[model samples]
Target: MPSIAYILSAIGIAAGITFILRLIPFGIKSILKDNKLIADLAAWIPMGAILILGVYVMAEIDYSSTTTALPYLIAAVVTVLVHSWRKNIALSLLIGTATCVVLANWVF
Candidate 1:
């Protein structure tokens, strides 16, 4: 088991590094206000960040056991299909989770 002090120290270090990195872009924007290229690139940063996170989540899935993943896979697929059909994220998520629970027990 990990110690609380080590966990807190790691968390603090991570937060501090992230905060400093975030400030770099803002500082650059101020210094290069007249550069349209820099501004245009910065505009796509959010989309790039989202794409990176999405890929990370997808890539991190454990495929070694179907038992744990099947439910989540079913839920995600149901969520997408329901959202596509009904155009309601909240309803889709709720129904997806219910379907996943039912399917999990039914299949596995």
Candidate 2:
């Protein structure tokens, strides 16, 4: 177990970092507001984040066994198809997660 002094210092460091991060938006709020480049970056960031998450998830799959991999593959397909059809990220993610959960719980 860590000493109280060590724990308190760690917490203080975390708090300080959080305060600095929170202050950054205030410092740049005016520059961020109504900036087309920032707006464009904000729009693309979420989709990019989703794709990166998908890649990481896909990389974790055990490809040697078809049974274990089937649900993940199916979920990926469902996510892509739903996204293409609806063009809604949240809905597609929800449906894909539901599909994966159902398949893992009941089908597999």
Give the per-residue lDDT of model 2 (tens digit) for 32-74.
Answer: 7999999999999998999899999999999998878999999
The clash count of every prediction, one per candidate, is 0, 0
Q: Could you tell me which 10 consecutive residues in candidate 2 have the lowest summed lDDT?
A: 63-72
lDDT of 1 by residue, 1-108 (tens): 899999999999999999999999888777899888888988898668755854685577677888867776877788779989998756876898798788778877
- Pairs of residues at least 3 apart in sequence or in different chains that clash in candidate 2: none
Stretches of candidate 2 above 4 Å error? 1-24, 34-36
Against the true structure, whose TM-score is highest? Answer: 2
lDDT comparing candidate 2 with the true structure: 0.94
Give the true-structure RMSD of model 1.
Answer: 8.9
